[model samples]
Target: MSRQVSKKAIRDSKRTFGNQIIFWMFKILYIIYYMLV
Candidate 1:
């Protein structure tokens, strides 16, 4: 049970990390778009 919990925590962290990366990427793109406009 403890192992499963740890596995889930790791998976959740990975998902959050991925989301953070995407968020930053989108922000950068938005800034570039505004600059180009």
Candidate 2:
């Protein structure tokens, strides 16, 4: 039971990390677009 809980926590963290990376990528793209405009 404890192992399953830990695995779930790890999975959640990985998903959040991936989302954070994607968010930053979009932010950078937006900035570049603003600069171009």
Segments of candidate 2 deviating more than 4 angstroms:
none
Model 2: worst 10 consecutive residues (lDDT sum): 1-10
What is the lDDT of every predicted structure here?
A: 1.00, 1.00
What TM-score does each of the candidates earn?
A: 0.86, 0.86
Candidate 1 local lDDT, residue 11 = 100
Candidate 2, clashing residue pairs? none
User: What are the root-mean-square deviations of the candidates from the true structure over C-alphas?
Assistant: 0.7, 0.7
lDDT of 1 at 26: 100
- What local lDDT does model 2 show for residue 33? 100
**How many residue pairs clash (N, CA or C atoms closer than 3 angstroms) in each of the candidate models, in the order given?**
0, 0
lDDT by residue for model 2 over 1-37, one digit each (tens)? 9999999999999999999999999999999999999
Residue 10's lDDT within candidate 1 is: 100
